[model samples]
Target chain A: MKSPLQYRILPLGDHALCIELGEIIDASINQQCIALFHQLKELAIPFIKDIIPAYASVTVVYDVAAIRKEHPSAYGFMKEKLEAMLLRIDTDQPLSHRKIEIPVCYDLSLGIDLQEMSQEKNIAVEEIIRIHTNKTYRVFMIGFLPGFAYMGSVDESIITARRAQPRTTVAAGSVGIAGEQTGIYPLDSPGGWNIIGQTPLKLFDAKRKQPVLLEAGDEIQFVAIDINEFNNYNLG
Target chain B: MSIQVIKQGIADSIQDNGRYGCQHLGINPNGVMDPVAAAAANLLVGNDLNEAVIEMHFPASVFLFKEQSMIAICGADLLAMINDVFVPVNTPIIIEKNCVLQFKKPLSGARAYLAVKGGFELQPWLGSFSTNTKAAAGGFEGRNLKKHDELNFRTVQKYGTALKNKDCEILNWKASVKNFYPASPVIRITRGSEFDWLTEDAKKRLQSDSFIISNQSDRMGYRMKGDALIIQNENQLISTGITKGTIQLLPDGQFIILMADHQTTGGYPKIAHVISADIPALAQMNAGEKIQFKLIEQQEAEDLLFEQQQQLLQLQNAISFPLLKFKQQYAID
Candidate 1:
């Protein structure tokens, strides 16, 4: 129960725990990763404060009092427990998958950078619209901001790097592309991603029962709407 | 009652202890930079620890009613004056209405705190009166006080006896202010989660090196320039909850120390976290001044924090305010 995979858990200062996941950024391994995450959730140690999952690694935070009971140093104790968990990985079982459809408005007024992106890609604006609405993108992780989902494996044709300088403000629900990753802005924050469109749907709402609309391992598809429909979409 | 902001030097805002327990909502706990000084100022004026106080960056002087009322100023010696007469720092003073308070250029330190009795009465948002300028929430209508804005205070009938003898006994009370603030720029820190990820050379530099605070700094985070701390393991980090004093390693190898208005979550590798007790020292640091970190064991850090808490409790008991005693008794009844 303690060991999950060949994960090297290193102690980060006194409060944080870092698990070095080598350097693989494949989306296929998330199934095993999420299953292990569920296992850890079930075991539920008291000292654990929070677990943050990224593309290839997960960092766990814990209290010192609960960590030092069995071991002398928090570093040694966390590493041992994590190494043990890695050894007992149940690879046969798969993680659960969730489907989340997001509503997007491809209007030129709302989608500030779509025309520019279409021009850069040398594709017609309608083709850019069709390709964007066509695929089901998998969420790789959530990072940068609260409820900000990193959904990716975008089409090679649409692959683009971030802007040279980040914009001072990217409106909330802005669907942007940075490198190969496509994500929706959960908050009105400064960002460098190339914005393609905007979603009327709230990616993250503090008032909602579940703040984040999509978690890691969820499948998503963007459905386009006209400007009138986007304007009428209930923000609340 | 509140004094109008005739001259808002550098930056001034109403802050309490801080707005905690809101990280999950992506809101940073915007509060006082030097909580020790803020709490001390509050103590001098017989206010609760969480009472709202004005945090003045550099110098802040105001024009208010000159009537006798308990007020305390702490942090940087901003050559403060009341009606052209010099007012001692750290000591609670009673002044008459129409007295003008002006702060000279800060001789030392970056910020100062002014706490009044009964605390400033302001509407709180999300259960806190703290102003988070980034989110544009809380404090004085969700922003800093402007010219001609007069804030009202919560009325308290119980006045400290020290209020009566403010003129004659001011010098002796000022001595009490020297105990908490030290002259040195050394701040104690606990090793961060990614401390080992740093190269041994970087780790040594961190221990022995002196850092200069950059000018492009704000309440959100302080960008510092020093020896680049290279991370040996260049793995991507997941975004997680970050607290005040969190030292994040940016992509450029620069150190960004999270302060009161830092982001709720971040993905950068946290190299170290300054102990909560030493944050006051960090708050006092001036831009371009040399600062160094003193490494301490986690246990020692925790112990120092507990000791500081004890000292605060002791200070609270030392006040001979009869009304405070009566109020405590009243609460019990």
Candidate 2:
């Protein structure tokens, strides 16, 4: 079976390729990305610094010296290598997704924009909670801040616009929903996202070997917790 | 040997080459804005070019030394003094223990670099001594320098009284500190991705109009004010990879010059990138300076960059080889 996602390996200069995945932010697209990532790792073609996978694309940064060493005078070798491997795309197999239970404290004190969102949506505050918590979010990408995962397809009922102006500082782990998107503030930074809840979980810890608790393709379930449970959940 | 700070400036922090490889995670590389000057200062002190040094913005004052060490001030004419005596720019000065080195207000330029011998040693985070202030990652405690912080200088292979004797005043040195600055505040820029989005008149204004460097500027970005760069289509695109010196055109037609500490990715359409060679000049620009961008071909920019890299490599080689030979032949007696 052919894969749902088709990627065009666009050469960026001599040392990089922008893996442009066709539009569609879904599970099938994610599977193709995960498969490609695993395939590159298994091949272990040298000179690659990293494969930075985003929502619908992955950019591979490579060392020029290594590329030249591996494919002497072959200008188009990298592109050819990537194209040849696309035929072997494992479509049948679905990669295992990790379940990350994010304990969120929905305290209005911490959730700075909860009341505003609740009022704007013309829904009860409790209904907002139910709609937000009921769905399992697919971690499409991680960006903007360190370890900040961009998970998506929040219910249309909870669609809310960002504040006209961003807050000067959004504390780390502050959960926010903007329009149809939902994400966590991975670091204490100036942000414009509509913060509705806060997770006490340390989503990003520089001291940790992996640093980021969740990666792309992981499933996230926001479990509403009391202040006691939030305080109990250790922040890295 | 350790160097003690007698007075920390308005903003001073330990910086090296920079922490790379983590930009994808949105970690800003908070290194010396003027990397060229930082490297020069490092070279003046007989340290490896990429070693850590103090990156001082205007209003910096400090006292630090290592083993009766020498230091060089490479960027900004910030009225720097060694024990109340004026220390000339671009030259190495010997400062014994207890001697005070104060950096006065900026006579010209914004940032100044201070490099001590053997480089300042700080615990590195994520394979670099450079600090990421936004992420609070590298350098001393991952923050700006405060009053009375001690910086350690690592030991280096002994090279006696060689570079120190050659030039007493840095102005007389053969280093190409001149011809670096453009005639005016003219910054060369290439066409941005959304250059076409601008109307004919707007595009003409962009090429001709003068934009004042707004005071609403910092490590993150250099905000420019003057001509509102209104676009024909104000579509918000998905944020993507951004780099230092990227001129991002906002919907309002204002420009944000991304600096060293700018976000890794941005959604704004980039107008043009400030050439790598001109980045050092941009780093030293004080607020309220009037600036204009002149379009140059990408090939020309690349060629200029290649030449600059070649020249820097030559300088590195000169200090490493010929100077080492000169020291060996002349200093033995």
- What is the C-alpha lDDT profile of model 1 across B1-333, one tens digit per residue? 556777656578889877754443445568899888888788876778668888887657465642445678888778888766788787876665555777877877778888777777788866678886655567877677677767776773333453353432242343254555656778788887678899989888887899989988888778999878788996776554466788999988889888888765677888898876777878888778777888888767655655566676677667645435544643521
Model 2: colliding residue pairs: B192-B271, B229-B253
Where does model 2 exceed 4 Å of error?
A1-19, A22-51, A59-97, B156-174, B321-333
**The 10-residue segment with the lowest total lDDT in model 1 chain B:** B166-175
Provide the global lDDT of candidate 1 against the true structure.
0.72
lDDT for residue B53 in candidate 2, whole number 0-100: 85
Tell me the native contact fraction for each prediction: 0.14, 0.16
Best by TM-score: 2
Q: TM-score, chain A, per candidate?
A: 0.91, 0.91
lDDT of 2 at B255: 89
Candidates, DockQ: 0.23, 0.31
